[model samples]
Target chain A: MAYLELNNVHKTYIEGEEEILSNINLSIEEGEFVAIVGFTGSGKTTLVNLINGLLEPTRGEVLFKGEPVKGTSHERGVIFQNYSLLPWLTVEQNVLMAVKEAFPKKSKKELTEMVAEYVEMVSLSHAINKRPKELSGGMRQRVAVARALAMKPEMIIMDEPLGALDALTRGNLQDEILNIWGKDKRTALLITNDVDEGIYMADRIIPLRPGPRATLGPEFKIDIERPRDKTEMNDNENYKQTRNAIIEYLMDIGNERKSEAQEELVLPDLAPKDFVNQFK
Target chain B: MKQSVSLNTAGKIARFNIFRFLFQGSIAKVKQMDPKVALKKVAISIASILLFLGLWHMGAKALYNKEADFKINKALEERGQAAADSEAACIASGNPDCQPNTLPSPAQVWASFNSLLKDHGIISADKAAFKEKTAALNAQREAENLDPIVYTGRPSFVDQIWRSLGTVFAGFLLAFFIAVPLGIFIGLSPNLKSAFNWFIQVFKPVSPVVWYLLVFMIVKTVLIGSPDDSSFTISFVSVGLCSMWATLVNTAMGVSSVDNDYINVAKVLKLGTFQKIFKVILPSSLPLIFTGLKITLSVGWMVLIAIELLAQSPGLGTFVWEEFQNGANDSNAKIIVAMFVIGIIGFLLDRIMLAIQNSVSFVKTDAI
Candidate 1:
């Protein structure tokens, strides 16, 4: 049986309205890293929320480990895009809250050590006592990552976690996340808009065609070896072909949608008013 | 020995650091402030206050002269020129009976303030003496399970101020306890909020006097057989009910408007209902809650005087009422003194609440 599966999932916020997601089907085997790349506002977040059990599918079934998903559980840890660290709590406290909740049987000392370890892993040990307001955007996102990872969930779900960070910070965090995921080889789902980010981190990349009834497209398999170096990938054959193919496909669909939306306006055969002639 | 000495020195340094930390923020702020701007602000405030006092003095003098003239003219009309002259002479002589019983001048109010302080001192001495005199009798009364002989003297102005403070604090506590939990419950669901909306709106604007009467009716009957006084209870409860509406409304709004992101985080963490409220909802809404509390406290203080007067509680309200009824030579000045005390206390209460709010809230907020 697949580790996590979504079968014919359909969702709409309002009853009898245009569906935000329709006829969605996905299945991830254990220890598989899957990335879903899509444009902004393409219902990517709604898809992530459904898989994580934050939202229920309006139509179909989402099964996890051979059982149907019910509500949210700590097993599917989500690193939210907006760095939803509780503003009132310090970084350590924020991580500690999640760790304690996920591992209720763990001792306080154990939880504290786990929080410290994850914070250090994200290179934010110095900011352990700082509140979210006191941290930079990149630092806040790092804290969110630490909070999600410290719970030691079976799956790591990221929703464009580095979207708000600058290029340099984003690069550093991508490697850090890759390193962490490689250590455990946990089942991971990364929802992002960056095509290169999907190719680098995900074993298989899929595009979510743009919505109001968005569905998944054909998958691209990345047969590249583990620990893929960014610089060397430029000279590699598979990387060039994959990057070109994904970009071209995205552009083609994007242009197709644009043309479909642009209906040529036809004006009626009309002339200027004859008021001047009438007055003369 | 070296380690022990270092530890001792470290402890001493830590003690000094405590004081340093307490004042460091304000000292830094002052140091960072531009000297010229700070001076200008101080100068403006002083000038405005002086101008207010000058206007007040002029108004008082004009009213005094008008009353004096009217009195002399009435004497002349009733009697003759000699009587008018005598009346003018009496007014010029600065007799207490001939003084205008109108708004007291700032100087008169200041004098009244000092006189009240002096009266408090005398009353303290008298109470001490009374305590000494009744010590043995009180012991016997205690043994016999009888009420001891108490001081029959009136409460001093300071005592009345303390009484008012106590009542207002009690009222504030009542308001907080009643409003916060009820607000949270109402805030959690839209249906509850809608159900309670009309009820809150109706009661919010009801006058303090009416609230006092309502409370009095209920409390009087409930405490009919009890030995303890119910007036204090009625007064505080009335003030609480009268002032709690702002807090209730603000709290509901705060809770309902918590950021969706935080709520999602709570859900993702699988937080229980109470856990979600405490860990996510309360912290996110704390800024608004504090804003509500600040309004509630100020409103409670504003209505307390009226409630206390109606309840006949021994507070500044009753003192003002009594001084007005007394109509003695210094009665008007004493009343004015009470007015200033009430205003100053209300201002201080707001500042204190603001300080507390600033400390507790994650975000900065302002209150006046």
Candidate 2:
């Protein structure tokens, strides 16, 4: 059975209103690295939230380990784009808090060591005592990544975690996260607007169309070999086809949305006399 | 043999650094440190205070007129007596209390402060004597299985300060207990937020005096059969109710406005409801809630004086009111001293709250 599955999932915040997501069906196998690419408001967050059990689906089910996903669990760790580190806690304390909660049975010394280890992994040991306000934007996101990885959850979710970082930092953390994931082979789901990032990081890529009724688009498989080099990928044949195809597909959706908006103008109902008077 | 530096030397080094930062390094640091701005800030503040005092001296000297002699001479002239009779004659004849009411000069206020301290010392001595006398009687009463005699001595100036502080604290603590939990509950539930919002708006604007009277009526009725006069309870309860509105509003706002991202993080962590509150909800919203609490504490302090005056409680408010009614030669100056003391104490109270607020928040509390 797939490690995670979303079966015909539908969600609308308001009852009987337009749906944010409709008929989303996905199955991610164990240890699979999957990335969902979409526009900014394409219900990607809603989808991730549903899978994390932060929000309930309006219809259908999100299954985890072949069981229906209930409420939130420690098994699914989330790294947010905005670096949602608690503004009041030092970087070390922020990671320590999550570790403490996730593994309450660990001794204090063990917990401290684990926290230090993960923080060191993210190369934030120098800033272990600094609060969120004191850290640079890149450092804050790194701390968040450290916080999630430290939990050692069954699955890791990244909601455009590097979306806010500068190009250099984003490239660096992306590699760092990829390195960490490679070591553990943990099931991972990455949500990003960056198509190249998805193709580079994931074994499979799925596109989510823009909403008021967003649905999953056709999947693209990256049969590229493991340990792929980003710089070398530019000259690679498969990379060119996949990147061009995804961009072409997204552009088509954008145009589709635009024309659909143009076609959706409603004509007001009027009596014959009122309709004739409109000309005058 | 060469030895590595020990923890003790490390500790000393740290302490020396802080000391340097304050003394010599501070000036150098001011040339280089933040809070480095500290020395210049303090210097300017002291200068401003001196300037203020100088202005006050000038204003007071100009405002106070020697009207007593003029009034007395006019009265004498009306009665066809020698209006040239020296005003000094009245004083030389043992009438020393001849000063007219005016805003006291800073020097006069300083003199009154010293005199009030002396009076407080005398009152303290009296209280000690009373306690000693009652101690023996109290021991005898305990031997006889009777209640001990209570000391009913009047509260001194210092005692009034302590009383006011105690009353304000009691009110603030009570308000915290009532408002914060209610606020969290209301914050978490939209239905409750809407339900209780109207009540909060209405009661928040009600004056402390009205609250005091309302509490007095209720407490008075309850204590009719009971011998313990409940002025303490009345004053505190009124102060709490009067000040609670700010805390409640602030707490609810803080709680409700917590980042949706953090809330989602809490859920993803699989935290229980209790864990969600203590870990995620309380900590995240603490800054705003503290902003509310600071307002609550200050409001409570501001209202306690009026509440004390109305309730006949022994506090600084009553002290000021009593001095106003005394109509003595130095009463105005004494009142001025009380005014300065109240202002200083209010400032201290706010600093105490700020210290606490800073300790809890990850964000360093910045000054206004």
- The root-mean-square deviation over C-alpha atoms between each candidate and the true structure, in angstroms, is 4.9, 7.0
Point out where model 2 deviates above 4 Å. A104-117, A125-129, A258-280, B1-47, B66-77, B80-95, B129-142, B146-153
TM-score of chain A taken by itself, candidate 2: 0.93
Model 2 DockQ reads 0.60
Tens digit of per-residue lDDT, candidate 1, span A194-215: 9999998899999999999999
Q: Which stretches of candidate 1 lie over 4 Å from their true place?
A: A264-280, B1-28, B366-368
Tens digit of per-residue lDDT, candidate 2, span B1-368: 13455777888999976555334422454566566477779889999999999999988766654455565667577753554355446534535465446788898899999998998999988988889878988999999999988767777889999989999999999999999999999999999999998998888899988999899989899889898868889999999999998889989999999898888777766667898898888998898889889899989988888999999888988998999898887888989898889888887677667767766676556544
Worst 10 residues of 2 chain A by lDDT: A262-271
Please compute DockQ, using alpha carbons, for every candidate against the native two-chain complex: 0.83, 0.60
Candidate 1 is scored at a TM of 0.92
Looking at model 1, residue B118 earns an lDDT score of 97
Candidate 1: pairs in clash: none
